[model samples]
Target: MSLYTTTLLILDPDPYNSIDRLYRRVIQQAMHVTLPTGCLDIFVARPPTRFRETHFVVAQLYKISAELKQLENKEDIDVRVLLEGVGGFDIGDARNRSWEVVAVGKSDSKLLPVFIAEQHSSWFSPALQIIILPMERSIETSSRLPSLPSDEDGSHPPTEEGPHLGEAGLVIDSTDEEGGDLDDEGEEAQYPIVALGGTFDHLHDGHKILLTMAGFLTGESLIIGVTGEALLQNKKYKEYLEPFPQRCAAVLNFLAYIYPALHATTDEINDVYGQSVTIEAIDALVISGETRQGAKLVNQERTRRGFHALKVWEIGVVNGDANDQWAGKLSSTDLRKREFEKGELAKGQGTQQKLE
Candidate 1:
């Protein structure tokens, strides 16, 4: 445990790759590959076939994100953009009306990426990080993080020394040394594009880390997106969590209290130079470390289209109760049994007499 080892990986896909192409990008079919855990995310590819956009195209995403947040009880939905093609408001006006309102806009190239990442993050990873790629050739090709070597012994190596007490018995600086910096940037860095993605089911401690990281890095308002139930239609991972509607509500609850335009915050998401940059106007994105490769590629695509390539910002992973027996992959049948069993076990332990 003296020296810890963790590496960034990039998954390179072959055009002839036989792997289900659906997993390539975020889409409605996510439930297929992903387990039906209420809080997990899976990406899918929208095979390029032109489809007409309607009023509520991307509107569902914001609603979903907000609902998911509410279900978790944290209740803070910050940023979102939709692909409403006609019957509703445009992306620029995403926040003019409440998430409850309908929107309208054509499915632009950028909206899909945002929608996919958030929608999936709400369920798959919980700690959501969304990265949307404008449907333009920003980069020639994309890459992924190198896969890690699982411990053959069936256990993970110590990432670092266990937490240690500090001055006044405090757990001082147990964090990784190589974390993202807060104040490193220039003009180009200020207004850089970003790729945002996630499955933010029960926004927990780890999820907050990701959000904090994104806000710190961009120094501006962020853009968020998620998948739709119509697209998330049939999946495997939906057992022990709230549905999309509830999840999005949780998120919006959190955002209102924190950035409620009336709250007091020292570290506000100011513009590149302290300008007005709130959720209604996003210039950057917040993403999870679990999904850097796909996001990077999308950013590259934007660059090719004469758009600012996104500067990657990271939220260090935070831990949550999902590690408990109650939370896990969703099954069509009985997945909640784990939670029930754990509860029974606790009850039995309480009644057992302790031997002196």
Candidate 2:
């Protein structure tokens, strides 16, 4: 199937109750029309309350993505949630360990064939390949691009033109005047330098949320310690573990897109402490909920070395439905295993066909 490598989805919560239904319908429709395999950038606009309630946004998106796996012919879509634009809020003082709201915006060129709910259509222009949600059992748009068939029937035509920005819309660029100055009163002052460590193997949404939270906290620099080869020898599906360089590059690239305003540094760490124990300048450490105990060990080592204890912040794990084979947490190891299973299934199907 022909797919759009990257697509933008603009969302605005009209009554809050429809958010979940709206998201599911949009995904169901897009699968038929655009086949977004590379990435799905969800841009939420208006209703400043949604910005303040970020935990809801993150949880809802993750829920929808998890449900996508149950759908037939669902592709692996990298779901990214953005909360920056007209009537949107900035990444405020979201340092608490609780699932607080943290706004996000990206700097990317026009994403073609944008999918938006009919109620939130006022946020963008109609000249682009715009697909409205709650679709009339058909793919409807005002763009000059040819009309495509619905998810259930008809031909899937390719869209040639790119996305268009609304006259009053914001692109959330760091260099551009409109998107500039996102940080108010040195938002980084709370934490001059933020630090975090992870294996970052497959670079999934869980990793993105962790990194973004750290990036949002950083005022000066974001220090990421990518696990070295020595530490990853026993990882599950070790063969599928991405090379350290590739993993590091993916982390850096994602940071540039989501929070380009700050300078980020990545280091290869052979041990658990990494630079967090040695770097005296680091103001804070971002960790997942499961590693809260490790934060104490890090601080104890720092205090032993005559260094100040770093203020540690935590982010909750992105969870999938509990099942016998898969735990609740969205893990890279589980992702790798799923990929391996898919490969094995395809191999079995191919062999069966050959025998026939």
Candidate 3:
């Protein structure tokens, strides 16, 4: 099977809310639609800052990967997430970056880079482009490429020229025509105040996804419960754990970046329930699949305390690749273990050099 590395360019005005649907489309394109043969590398490029955080975007990619494993029954496609920096939104800049990412060494190859975008534009040189329309359109896959004008007799004529290769290689273009259309969709089902509790240690991509989802579900404010040090005493690699203040700062930094308008507050919690069980203002609770039972327990406590049971929203666990030395769901424990092993290896090398 031939492997094709394709970079998908998306103009996501608001990823925190649209990521779920965007990811679904990516999976559909790779599995049920085009490029089902070889290994497909889907690098999703989105504009940065106002509504999207790089970390959050990567987390969504991980979620997509996990879903693909279940839906496709294998890891044939590798999904990577890339962020278009502050000033890289221009069509030319995006084309340059996409080519740089996939064009590692095929300088003399005849393969023209495939460019997929929502609308057809002359800005892209037709002689140097292979444009694929968005998946939602009903056009045939072959019809997506720009076709030469037919003869007046309505018969298709063969042209001397083939598809022109773009200067930067393959380019895929896509637009977010649905942007802001679904913004209020989450509003109708909004929770005025949402609460989520976690150790948030090291704040990996998984944590960012959880935080981004929580922020998107919220309408007015969000309360993050950072686990206190006392609760992490029994955790593995406790010595390497980040301090509570640092963890809180990292969480807030991400929340602020993706949700600048959201009102956020962080507090220390020694217990699993935190203020969720007692806080009447909190309308919902966000948790990961692993901690879902904990959310139920918090609800139980709330019921006992005469408070309304908080709505529970669970995000799936971001699984790690089996190819990884430490294969399992992403967690702080796995990260710390990797770091510890690297340190030990360094020390062993130092000792061996000294003895020699």
Candidate 4:
């Protein structure tokens, strides 16, 4: 089967209904058989006027994460989710203390693939060699493809009955013009400098989301604090931790790939505060919802230092397969443990083969 470096899928709002069957076919035909290098970017098309609930968007993201973890082949394909017609999803509560909206362009059918290919051409092939569409829309959509030659054409059949968005815990913010809630003046807030901290080991989709949000909010620079060995000593599978330099490089390389325009810098963080308290220029801090308390502590330190408190923004956790041992929030420690186990299993199999 021919392999594609980059592929695009235009999906509906409720993609969880068909995610399993859809990805199964995608992996079999379009993906690299041995080692996958590029990403499959899925743009979920929402009605231009309808408000996409933040919880529903997060649920779809976790559903994709869980499905990828369940695949036996485990080709390690990187999948990214983007919503159509919405710049970003604002997930904060009434006080807006939770998180800022991570901005993305409104999807244009004619320009989606072209824009992606142009931006990623430096790292991966520019052509979107495979285009996957819903079965109902495949025949009509095929006629609209750009001049690029496609290796394969694929479609997914319609899904069976599924729960309604509202029934599945969706909250509609009808007052806001877009996906996010507005300020008292009815305008979205923008920060010039944003900072976030993480281990960024084995950088995966979860890390990618956090980085993307921070970069999106940043108008001047995105400051990242990668945990140093001193801070990672107690982590599970610490034996497999990537060197500090490698971890920092991986985070910067990914930022360049996704947000080429973003001015980003990384620091080795031995302490939890990192540069968030030290740097007086930072306007906001982006963190995972699970790390809200950490953000609060950073603010306390900033206050103690006589600097103003930075705005706090939280991104929801991306979860892995619930049935497997790696289930729960997508974690780097779990990934390291998985690699160790795989190596051990290989060693045992090799010994048995030699004896036989």
Residues 264-323, candidate 2: write the lDDT tens digits. Answer: 889998887899988898888887756655677778788888888777665656663223
- Quality of model 1 by C-alpha lDDT: 0.30
Give the clashing residue pairs of candidate 3, or none: 113-170, 114-170, 114-171, 115-171, 115-172, 116-172, 116-173, 117-173, 117-174
Model number with the top lDDT: 2
Which scores greater on TM-score, model 1 or model 2? 2
Any runs in candidate 4 off by more than 4 Å, and if so which? Answer: 10-38, 43-62, 65-69, 81-132, 136-187, 320-327, 353-356
Q: What are the lDDT scores of the predictions, listed in order?
A: 0.30, 0.57, 0.54, 0.54
Model 2: lDDT to the true structure:
0.57
Each model's RMSD to truth, in Å?
23.9, 15.4, 15.6, 12.1
Question: After best superposition, candidate 1 residue 278: deviation in angstroms?
Answer: 18
Q: Give lDDT: candidate 2, residue 43.
A: 60
Q: Mark the 10 consecutive residues where model 4 has the least summed lDDT.
A: 92-101
Put down candidate 1 lDDT per residue, 1-356, tens digits, no spaces.
Answer: 11111110111111212112211232222212222222221111221111101101111222233344444442322332212221122232322322221111122233444543544544333222222321212223232212212266423232222111110010101212332121112222333222244544555433333443333233333444433444343534445445666555655454442333212122212112121122223355444434434444544455455554334443322221223532332221233355556778988887784531
Which of the two candidates, 3 or 4, achieves a greater lDDT against the reference? Answer: 4
TM-score of 1: 0.33
- TM for candidate 4 is 0.64
Worst 10 residues of 2 by lDDT: 164-173
Report the error of model 4 at residue 70, Å.
3.4
Writing each residue's lDDT as its tens digit, candidate 4 over 52-83 gives 23333435554554465456354376665544
